[model samples]
Target: MEFSLPDDNNNLSLTRFESMLKTNNVLFFDSNEFENIIYHYLENGKISLAKKAIKLGLEQHPTSTNLRLFKTEILIIENKLEDADKLLENLHDLEPMNEEIYIQKANVLSKRDDHESAVQTLLIALDLAEVDEGIADLYALIGMEYLFLDQFENAQHYFKKCLEIDNEDYSALYNVIYCYDFLNDNQEAIVFLNDYLNGNPYCEVAWHQLGCQYVIVEDFDKALVAFDFAIISDDTFVGAYLEKGKVLEKKKRYNEAIDNYKITLALDDPTSFALLRIGKCHEKLGNDDLAVQNYYKTVHEDPLLDKGWIAITKFYNKKKNFQKALFYINKAINIDGDNVVYWKLYAQINHRLNFIEEAERGYKKALDLGNYELSTWLARADILIALGEYEASILNLIQTAEFYPETAEIEFRLAGLHFTLHESSKGHYHLKNALLLNTDYQYILEELFPNILKKPSVQQQILNAGKTEN
Candidate 1:
């Protein structure tokens, strides 16, 4: 499609137009130039030119259904959905058998959130013609829509219809898997995906989905095998590698998990999540140095990644390296100052350094931040006891008990405090509870509180207290 501009001598001819279009590739002077014009207008968003080109093309073939589709496409592209619908309506009247026009209208309505109208339009198109491949694809599309809306039954109906039309439709198969998974029908998803893969062994998506379903069902061994097949089928598949690494981690195969993560990073770029997993595997394997190094890689790759810094700080702090732990913990605080874990890590490092004042303030800060979890509060209780603020420790312990009545640690610690202060009755009461909950802890019974074990009167008190509490 080209437009003719006369030469200086006022002569217009095909040879000149062809030479011009060839030189510039604009095709400004061809009889069928409307197609090239519409394409250029669409690619560059030249709406005015697109309209003019549509008009020019209609002059050549006024009943051209393809040109009408082009107009509808341009309108849809410009988000003039109403205009597109109107144009599609005109085309439908001209050619009542154009199933594609109905589909286009359905698409426009679906985009506008009119699912009912979209479904009806497609249904009408299906009624008009049953054995169309396009209708099968439309069924899959409607299934996806219903899936997103959490109408699993409706979605399954459409997806099954698509599979009935074409048993090998991957989109329909995946949709069915998704719908089942959404409904927490992991067993159903497993059966379907397994059957689908048996028929289509080369379906990487089905294998990947089957592995994920296995994980959801807590069948890690089968998950590993599925992901193994998934990765074997496509070595560059990042999703399979990641899931395989997770299965390995669940199986406690830390080395294999790290290897999988390494390959995932090599295929993709180094991600903080992968690095964090690598660090965790090392940490579980008791390679503190490698864990620390990998954690550093994670945080270094994304300086603002909080978990990586947290993992690094905790690993170093647990290893009794206060300085290194402080470095990463402080880095984490700098990244997420409001995070309770970051402040808790800071307090831990300070405790290790015997910086009582700093540790106290750090713990107090964490408490101030509204994280009254038992672990943080218990640490506070211990710190208070160390500082000889026994009253504060007791109060903190009581607060912890309110949140976790089943826990024995809080009561046991409270008993130790009361015993230290020689409050015999209260001490006996708590100690009896500790023993009842866990009689196997002989060290607490013997070494930690020797007086209670030796004194007959105190033993009697413990028995009375246990009887009363029970």
Candidate 2:
């Protein structure tokens, strides 16, 4: 959407402009020449040069609206919105039909967080746009404004309008798909991408997106075909290869997934993702040595990739090598201490090694980092009970019950903890609730509170519940 001069003319003008600046001589250039020089400076990010060019340009051609518009743009960039607005108002009076002026005005309004006013101004620019590219740009701008407002439907409509004007506008195509994704309309996205591909069959981006939509909808076969077509359209497309590898892995074609993943390595620099996936495929296929090699390479290529380290740790853990698992998980945690998955895995490995206090601390850190899953809560509470921290276990289970109310497991655990704490009244209350919810899980009571289960009153209550169920 930007215009640039030919290389020769651009170079000649730049040389002349520099010569004039160096000699402190007034050089006269027509409005078009000055505009090109200023554009060149702006495009190359020489803001001071651009400012000087604009100053000299207006001195020579004071009535040139284009040069003044450039000045207004710089004002907007410099956060002089008031001055930019004043300049735009004057420009609009001089040339009410100038679409660029309205566009610049919309830029200022968008910076001020006035998206509605920006969209209105862009609509005016759209109406004034006489060329296809300009109209498409206006549509994209309007779509972005609607996105800022979280109006996905409206954003989709405008971006689709942009595609109608230029079917090859990949930016607009991506935005249209993003809106559909935000609205959770994968089927519509698939249908739209299919229609788009029917016209532009060679668009790798659309084919790649279609594959992802199929993945979301769990149509693995269609996803595979889409990714294949994407690769055919652009054989060196790394994303297509990666998606195809994922689909193959889901289908349990581990060897085939490795083959496809290795293709990505040959086509470009080795990626940690591809290496990790290949390692997993090898592990699934019982290629332990190859799996270990790739896993080590994965971390070597990018030590910051926590998944690679976790993968290594899990592999060791699966083999009952607790020491090695603990070592790798420690490395992963060191790299990304805030990852809940790493903390949870750290807790599990420590627990396996009978390092109860460390395990408890790991679980507590996991919980603090927002690992609120039922398994994590139960593991932490169980660890606390093992450490004989009955009060802490009771409080942990109490909080877990808040997230998972009316659950027999939590209720049973709470009854066991209260009984262990000698809060017999509270224990009986929770025991009754657990039995009411699910008498089938009373085994939890037997497992955690066998002594309580032996009590005559508790046994009779459970017997009464069984008789009531019958």
lDDT of each: 0.78, 0.93
- Candidate 2 least-lDDT 10 residues: 1-10
Top-TM-score structure, candidate number:
2
**True-structure RMSD for candidate 1:** 8.4
lDDT of 2 by residue, 1-470 (tens): 25667989878888999999999688778888889998988888999999999999999899989999999989988999999999999999989998999999999999999999999999999888886657888899999999999999999999999999889899999999999999999999999999999999999999999999999999999999999999999999999999999999999999999999999999999999999999999999999999999999999999989889989999999999999999999988888899998999999999999999999999999999998999999999888888889899989998998999998888888888888888889988998999999988888878767887888878888899899989
Error of 1 at 349 (Å): 5.3
lDDT of 1 by residue, 80-171 (tens): 99899888988888888877788788779888888877878877777766565567777876776676567998999899888887776767
Q: What TM-score would each prediction reach against the true structure?
A: 0.64, 0.88
Model 2 lDDT on a 0 to 1 scale: 0.93
RMSD for all candidates, in order, please.
8.4, 3.1
Give the clashing residue pairs of candidate 2, or none.
none
